[model samples]
Target: MVESESTTKVNVLMVGTGEYTTGYVGGGAADSDKGAGVVALTMFDLRRRNKVSRVGMCGVNGKKFAGIRSHMQKNIGDVYNDMDLTCETFPEDTVVDPLAYEVAAKAFYPGDVAIIFTPDDTHFAIAMNCIQRGMHVMVTKPIVQTLADHQKLAALAHENNVLVGVEVHKRLDPFYADARDRARSNLGDFQYMYAYMSQPKHQLETFKAWAGKSSDISYYLNSHHVDWSEWTLAGMARPVRVTATGSSGVAQSRSMNTEDSITLTVQWENLNDQKTLGCAVYTSSWAAPKSDVHSQQRFFYMGSSGEINVDQAHRGCTVATDAAGFASVNPLFMKYTPTNGMFSGQGSYGVRSFENFIDACCAVNAGTAQPRDFDDGSLATVHTTMQGTAILEAGRMSLDMDGRPMDIQYDGNDHEPIAIVPHVFTG
Candidate 1:
């Protein structure tokens, strides 16, 4: 697929229209942090910048389209000086079709793109359909629940020559980027790493529909740290073994069968020498009480030479008011503040993550860059993030089997390292 012009813009199809797309969760805007959501807002901003063409949104329930559009118009469009937030819809009105994404995928061609922001379980199916249709795809993290599905998508994307990127936006964080750089240069070999990320309990209410029935807090929150760890130790170490444990009661008390908090202890073998190994402990929870911030995130990383600590929750910026009490703000993810009467979150890493993917797609279409060049770590493609998927799947399996530890077998027999789970039985 060759772009006839250098300035050609690719059409985008948004695969989900819930909180992340329209922020109309539970019949109103999100109760917690995100009021207008990220995906749709960012895409519209990209459109304004002339990087994207026509945009379309797909949802299983067509009844919610009117509300979603109104929500977008009121929150996004009006807030940003009546920005054009127009997009097509699938399933039409009065039709509830879970396979609506298939119909939406037909509108885009080989060089176009699709963003999958649906549940953890549906990512694989939607992304596979997009890839088969010769469209580049970007799926939200924890990409999929199974390592098998991750591998299949990777192979299919390669065969079809489409880019498949996992939306691990944390990699774009400035502090996180510095930490990763230090770990690679001055921090020496990987020694021990610990990361904790959590959200308020109300988030459970927002995701109650699928909290335990479809996926767990680990897959939802732990995905952040796991992907960060995998990215930090990219060429230095690889996870060889994993053991997972969980704490319950908080979610269960609310009729949710998911763990209140989950922790994974992964053993990483030194990439240079298989004989040497390091340990990484990653913990995540959605049971946090209401705090100054919506999410409590921090990490401690140690290497042979030195260590680094990051408290992402407190960026040294806090505010207090009579109406809202005390709260911490993070403009790094989504800068809601406008400049010159226009939406200006272009500097935010969260927005840059999506923009980076689109830029790569444009370059690939122009024949200036190959799909494999993205595997070199500009973005978290399926090929680059295979270790993260392997570790997460192994952790889930470990929890399923009564905390029994599982091993991550790396198949170097292929062109690059391919993570393999011996016998992954998901719960």
Candidate 2:
């Protein structure tokens, strides 16, 4: 017999306290788009709905909890009725521990859930720890910086019998989801795709601690479209090569040794027809001037039978205020506004992303579903997203090697990536 949702509610552990997790950066509430955050807010609401129980958050610096709680209280708790801001924080307030997440993970039992939103470099270790403990995990995009780590996580998740999802929220966007379906059903063979996403220059300040030191802009931004393209062309085509180029000066001027803009050009081969090929260009930057929206995201897709164009940043919705001036808003991604003294953004794609993961975890815990059950491409499981990781790592390698093209080699029959090698020249 299957257990009821109320009885099998999964406990959640959030593994980061940065901008995306809490919207509490540096000191107070983020001034950018995510004033209240996506993860914690969604988790709080999930708790309210009885989908989850006992929420906990872990971060390297324990001292930030006081400010984080205050920020959440003001932005989330105080604004929404019955919204609980209660969470167990890792590390004592006076102590700082880089490995505090390990301690936090021990507090939960097997089949619990963890959502990671940390730096690119820390994803592997943190996720590995969680999965090893038999906990389900949902990692932020660009899951890891290397293909080897990605494959390792996939193997370990299977070994531990846990579900591991990559939090590519764009896949849940209504427009993007519809486009993917149309491209798969109506559009013919893949041909070309162009994606551009950028954040304002101020983001460099928020990310200065690890801008180029830990990861680059392509891994930060391009991962979104790369994963989308991979999902869109799954089984239809596979990425063959990646060559990257980057421009600097803005970040350098800001005393950061990182590129201001980066572009990755990838070549894809149709699975059914090897002779036919497709190309995709993904560009990302953090040097964009301040605009009506926090990020400028748009993509163009072409196939043999049809084409698609999407401008996600501008959804034909704009708002003007005395203090904030003019701005374009996307309530579809996250509607932070309250309705009837309650949180009403449950229909948002961002909220759905977390809710979906929680539901999967609960199902697994209830013995109604297995971890591998989610690998059917419905969710961003570790198995289905290997190609995206390969492309992202290859792009980073190309940029580090002065723009040399890298070939993505896959194993026979399995279609899993085996190696990423430099392109060989022949006369």
Candidate 3:
């Protein structure tokens, strides 16, 4: 494989459509479509800031339902039709076209970076292929579901010195950076951090759910949890040991082996004077806490001087210190008003998170930005696997049966079972 460089602009092709579908919700909902919204935002930035051109969409030509492809066709405006990555029609628009990867490898030059937007399992193949061909890579969070897989990726990345990154958009968010600032400014070192992405157990049931279904969730939700821990702390430490206890409700209901909910005590040696973050998630059987907080994603970081909170649904971040007060809150998230993005423009790429990948890839090509590396990916991946074990152990409580009161124990190695993502670093 030959080293490749940017000519005038970098080309980007999304490997998945789920993000695009999220972008199409009409009204304010569309405004919050961060995936599409940020991508579009980056396009505007490319033109205004760098004067670079946009590369078109990636997919088999015949696949019809992919909203990302459609959005690109509509948004890329003049050149949308020219962006097809595949030579043949996709099997179906709503479905994944496994065959598209081969075509994309051929479509891109050896140096071009391919950001894997699909599920975690498919990432290994595409990433390995890209490395073999000497192309660069970026991916959505949690690169793979198992540690063994992460090791394979690590070996390849070291062998080639290729830059790879997981989506982990939160790291780029202004909100998270503040937390980093607090830690770096001598406000405090990482003492504790907590994150959650709990949903009902029934929400996970599927016909074949029994076997490997939660394998995805174990990585999906936990990736964010562990990533935030590392990001807020700015200290990457592998969980020394872990153990989880939870029920097989999703498995019981759907014949799956994955647990519905769990709690974990993740041990990191670097932790001394600094606090730590807690990891929490909701299973179908979860009863809302006595408090009125009803939501999915939540992360909180506490330092000696201040504290920061990251909320998912509202898409906001708040920094507060008892010394000053909470009213001085700062808004960290970008808004999605009609006035925002390129909605007024004639094209569909109206802006989304995927666009960030484009900008990051372009910068890497231009030698301006370095993509995240495999080390970051592996740390977050392994930590999440350990946390999932904890969540499963949380499910093992009697209260889980009917939301009744039960004792929750803290065990050092209870959830220490195994590994679980799309996030590999791009460095």
Candidate 4:
């Protein structure tokens, strides 16, 4: 609890940088490890933003980081020098050595926080250490794989009084924040919503690696759509039942173990036990023009007065009347291109997410921060897992997941006709 007259500061510790292998499909091949991208961006942001002072990075090792450490260690602005947050240096902070995680937890002060930039599987262990040591944590998405694990993590975060938030970029993005605000405003009564996701084939490879053979395509991709729908559509309808139809034509065609195309059919029961507007989503890894795909994300809301389309891929959107007339304009797009600006500097996923978490922790540490918390993360993830599992089963024509029917919502309701059956849906 050290406080100076002018300002107070909180240090951040990070863990699990050991160059990892994500257990990919087709005999588990090796691919690029995640997290470094965010670290590199954070260093650059610190050098440019001049807000935070320094970060204590841990979990890096002697071998994998050997190639890039020299450059990063000198650049990332550690405390070795009088380098405050504004001044920049070279060679990133790998925090290598034997037993870095334990060493990191031991070093964090009460007013300091820790960020975990590792995989989903390592969340509990690394978080447990950080929380026990009186440090807050900002973890990446999908912290835990199953419901049981979610329960444990939630308990730990609260019991420790340490703030824990999962990285869901849209939650923090002004783009989404504005849309959410409007949805609650004159957008009339919020009925149902739809979220669409279309990414490149490589995303599947990335998924198989992190998720392993047992993990399905639906789990990684559709989970995003499902979770967001629950969030935007006012608390996930509690999903009475979910039915899906998927395709492995592209995945199998590529010799991957998961499906490539999946359309989710969700049935949600409104208050008083009656099902209302159905929210259906379709995710495709096989969209036309792979070169131009995944450039953005989009959403649509069905309100009584009018509708809103958050055309995320194109940067922003245009709300129009059903008569196809321009209603109004709200231009909220990224000025920078994905190839450079957003993903590179200004708005990279890892950097933005990591920064938000750190700021949240720093606040709490200084008696001022507000993390999104663990329960929020748990709910989103559980909703995702459940929805994704149902989608995968619908693809395989199975009603079971781990020896169960995978409870979800599915009903035959579509104004424009939704493909509830893959055989019938595809054709």
Q: TM-score, each model?
A: 0.95, 0.98, 0.61, 0.64
Residue 426, model 3: Cα distance from true site in angstroms: 40
Judging by TM-score against the true structure, name the best candidate.
2
lDDT of 1 by residue, 1-427 (tens): 5442333678889998888777889778987667888889988888888999888999999998888888888888878974788798998978999999999998667888899998888898999999988888999988988878888988999998888999988899999989889999898888899999998998999999889888888888888988888888877788888999999999989988899999999998877654578899999999999889999999999998999999988898888899889999899888887887789888998789999999999988877888889997789998888778788888888898898888777667222335545445689
lDDT tens per residue, model 3, 1-427: 4535454465444454443322433221232224343443344445444433433334433344454445544544333222222222234445566576776667666556665655556777777887676665666666754455655765676566555555565555555555666655765544455666654343343113222542434455556566555554434232433333454454455555555554443444344444343322332222223111222666676555666776653544443457534321212333332333333322222232344545555565666744443244332222233332333333333223443222223244343333331113358
Q: 51-91, model 4: which lDDT tens digit per residue?
A: 45555555435344443344334332331233233321112
Ranking the candidates on lDDT from highest down gives: 2, 1, 4, 3
Q: For candidate 4, what is the TM-score?
A: 0.64
Q: How high is the lDDT of residue 63 in model 2? A: 94
* Ten-residue stretch with the least lDDT total in model 1: 413-422
- Candidate 4 — which residues are off by over 4 angstroms? 1-7, 16-36, 47-51, 58-62, 70-103, 188-191, 204-208, 214-216, 235-238, 253-255, 271-277, 282-289, 293-296, 316-353, 369-405, 408-427
Candidate 1 steric clashes: 0
Question: What residue pairs are clashing in model 1?
Answer: none
Locate the minimum summed-lDDT window of 10 residues in model 2.
Answer: 1-10
lDDT of 2 by residue, 92-193 (tens): 787799999999999987888899999999999999999988888999998999999999999999898889999999999999999999999998999999
Give the better candidate number (3 or 4) by lDDT: 4
